[model samples]
Target chain A: MIRLLEHEGKALLGRRGFAIPEGALFPGLPPTGPWVVKAQVPVGGRGKAGGIRFAATTDEVRAAADAVARLVIGGHDVRAVYVERRVPPGREVYLAAHVDRDLGCPVMLACPAGGVDIEAVPHERIARVAVDPLAGLGDEDAAMLARALSPDGPPPPALRRAVADLYRTLVEEDAELVEINPLIVGADGTVTAADARLILDEDAAFRHPGRRAIPEGTAFEEEARRRGVIGIELDGDIAAMMNGAGMTMATLDQLVAMGGSVRGLVELHGAMARGPDHLAGVVALMASLRPRVLLFNIYFQFRNLDTVAEGIARAIHAAGPGGLPPVVVRIRGVREAEARRILEPLDCWVTDDFARACARAIELSGRPVLRR
Target chain B: MAILVDARSRILIQGITGETGRAYAARMVAAGTPLVGGTSPGKAGQAVEGVPVFATIAEAVAATGADCVLSSVRPAAALAAMTEVFEAGIRVAVLYTENVPVHDAMRMRALARARGACLLGPNSAGVISPGRANLADLNDARVRAGRIGVVSKSGTLTYEVIDGLHAEGLGESTVVCLGGDPVVGTGFAEILRLFEADPGTDAVVLVGEPGGAMEHEAAAVVRTMRKPVVAYVTGQRAPPAKRMGHAGAVSGAGAEATTAAAKLAALRSAGCTGVDIVTDVGAAMVAALAARRGAHAS
Candidate 1:
């Protein structure tokens, strides 16, 4: 899931025929007064984290914007700030649409209790309606959601239209989540999205070319993105690389179980599509961590193991002696003999046994093996 | 007999012109998996490894009476390819493509259920009925057909568990990889039900990881099962919110549903012998199956 910044999310909502606050990204503020300076971060609970601040005047807005731009919320640097025209106190409601895994469908959630923490609200106050992927959100579903949010009386047509539009944005954008915390119902019955959060489905990037512009979280992430692999940094001393995600996590679990820690993990997404050069680059990137032991727990089914073995051999040769950490490899499947033959010259411990490879990695890392 | 595929199961390879597809086709043919035909849009009338190729799944099915499809299409073409398979009345499909859109996955899953067919995965390693059909990404030579039914969320984790089981002189009746997506076509409960009804399967090994409530749902099924289930839940020490390679293997904020400890506890409460360590999975399965046999004998 790639989280869209506040401006980007609001722009999308606005495009789908929803009302958004008059706002602009920092350095280009809206012409009017009484603005809310919000630090543009992907994470939630920013309001509680001092990421959102109110400014009464233009001078105050500039000051708040500067403060927000310099702040780091949720470990993410605040590169941009959203300065929006602050709406007056009104009926604030929580409205969100997300794909519910258990329900196996898109679900729209609405609550009369809004503007505040929706998690703190009682279960009875929140109304959830599962949107049919086939039929989509019907008029009745929209009306029902409106009524659920405003049980005291009939909700205005604007609220109903907003609900419909929200559902449309969720489906049309291929977004995993589209949330409007504190969807302000003004005194004049106009509904405006005060804050928005949208997370687009990363897998659907083929459909949306604009998704390529989203920034990576870290330098390692950026490099991994360029290399077409998934690299996550940790604080441990063992660098683990694997072919699949499930295998990567399981390897981490096994390593931790043996009293070893992981400094980083590099997952080979489409290892076969990429040749040995890519794998060699990935191995080089993993070596940059200077881990105590470079652990490779790769199990391939369709892809050739020899290519990976060649890549490992190449990476080790390029790194030279002592440039890389002591390596422990557990490779199997698809030309296992050729892979073994290729890696025969490398100064590494190679085994088909998963446990033995992990134990060896830990022992090489100087971490005490805790036998269970 | 195995729950999904057997020697009689006629297999069709979708995207057979591609590298991965051709590799799988060769392997399946070598294993004598009854590879009848394949489908590749515009590449129709061509053949890969003696297997006839058609323009559509319908054409392939008409020619070979293929009951199963192994799709290795690109991510963008996965949904359309699977739709064609389902429309052609194929009852079982193993989508080997990864990074498929969640919406497309949901649509494929819904269609599969509506057709009363089993869709293995959008990011799955496919399924392998050892000694019968080698549809999965597993090496057929290493896997032996036996009594233990294996179902897992991760393909690599399944390989490890299968190795451990083989080390203990046990083998799988049917190994199902439910894919590592947050939402999958086949869940643990559905597979467990199939394992329970299979006469060849004496015991079950559930290789699970922290993430999603699928494990808990599987535990609910385990509560009513007559056969013993030995479970190994991984990702115990993984940091929160970091996706552990698999898109579904992340523990979200305050949600214990996907935590390894919670999954193990839930399975144990449902009478499954939960192994904390992945290596101990085979021994636990042996002990659990032995306990069940002792009770039956007494």
Candidate 2:
């Protein structure tokens, strides 16, 4: 999911025929008296994190923006802030169009209780209508959602159109989720989206054409993406690399079960096809973590294991003798004899047994690092 | 006698002219698993490893009477390829392509269900009824046809399960990969139902991972099944909100059932012989099968 910042989500909503509070990314003020200054972070609970501030004057806007910029909420740095024209105090509502995986359909969710986390709201309070993708949103769907917003009488005109438009945006924009929290129904009866959260579908990039994912995850993960492999950096001491995602998780589970902590994890996504040099690069990336021990648990069927063996051998040789941490490998599958022969001369502990190799890596990690 | 596919099913490659398609074609021919025909849009009337290639799935199905197809198209062509496969009235279509858009998957899944056909995956490793029909990523030479049916999300984990089963002198009656996507065509419940009814399958081995309510849903079906299920859900120690390689493997906020511990516990409560570690899967299956036999004897 490509999580859009508050401003970005609003930009998408605004362009797609929704009335959004006039806003600009911080440092530039929107033409208005009182403004709601919000920290542009991907995480939720920014309001409670002291990431939100309201300012009535231009000078106050700048001050609030500066303060929010220095704040980090949910371990994410507030790289920017969004300032928008504040809507007058009015009725708060929670509205969202999301893909309901359990139902295998798109659903428009409307709740009268807004401003707070929608999950906390009782199930009976929310109105959820599943929309047919092929047929698109219809009048009956809009009417049902509208009734949720205005139980006593006719819904505000802004809402009657918003439900259908919201569902349309989800389908056309290829978004997994489009949410407007505290969709304010002002005293003047105008509907305003004060806050928005849009999660674009990453796989829909083919249709979207230039929608780049805001680079997420740690530097190791980013590097892994660049290298065409998958890497996740965690807070641990043992660094493990595996041939497949399932193996990666199973390896992580095994290590943790044995009381071993993993600082780095790498999955050789297409490394086998890319050959030894690419795998060596991934190994080098793992080695940079300065882990206590490096563990490679790789299993193959049709693909030869020698390619990975050579890659490890290359990474070890490239690191030069005594230049890297302790290494343990558990590799077997097709061409096991050839794979073992390739890694025979390396100083690393090589075995075909998964448990023994994991145990060895854990034991070595307990020892103080000799090289790093 | 296999659940999804067998020696009788005529399997074709949707993008047979391409590199991956050609490789699958060659492997299918080598395995002697009903190598029928394929489609390449422009490369009609060609042959890859003795399998005939056509202009489209419709033409391939008409010419060779193919009821099943293994698609190996690029990501951009993944959706269109499945659309053609489904439109041609293919009974079973295995979308071997990965990175397909979620919307496309939803559409194809809906279409498959509407047509009452089975769609394996958008990121699927494919399926194989060992020694009968080999459509999966697993080496055909390595696996043998047996009574235990295997179903999993990850192909690599399936590899481990297959090896464990082999170590225990067990072999699969059929292996179905539900793909590693957040939303795949088939789920654990569907496959478990098939295994329960399959005469070839005496017991089932369900390999699950953290992320998605599919495991819990499968647990619902396991409660009614007479066949014993040995379940293993990985990623118990996976960090929060982290996708452990697969697009779908994550225990995010509010997704309580997607966590490994929760899924495993759910399946165990459904009477599955739970395996804590993946390596213990084969032994757990042995115990579960024995328990079933002991019950039968009583």
Model number with the top lDDT: 2
- Could you give me the TM-score of model 2 versus the true structure? 0.97
Off by over 4 Å in 2: A367-372
Model 1 / residue B286 / CA error / Å: 1.0
Residues A20-138 of candidate 1 have per-residue lDDT tens digits of: 88998887888987899999988877887888999988889988988888888888888689999888777999999998776667999999989888878999889999876767888
Shift in Å, residue B26, candidate 2: 0.8
**Per-residue error (Å), model 2, residue A358:** 1.5
Q: How would you encode candidate 1's per-residue C-alpha lDDT over B151-237 as one tens digit per residue? A: 988887787788889888999899999888877788999999999999999999998887778889999999999999998887877
Highest DockQ scorer:
2
Given the true complex, what DockQ would model 1 score? 0.67
Q: By TM-score, who's the top model here?
A: 2
Worst 10 residues of 1 chain B by lDDT: B249-258
lDDT of 2 by residue, A1-372 (tens): 799999989988999988998888877878976998999999889999999899999999999999999998998999788898888888998889988766667889998889998878999999988766556678987888988988767887888888888988998999989999989887677888989999998888989988888888899899988999889999888999997788899999888777688999999887679999888989999989999999999888878899999998999999998877998989878889999999887898999877778788888988432211
The iRMS of the candidates, in order, is: 1.6, 1.3
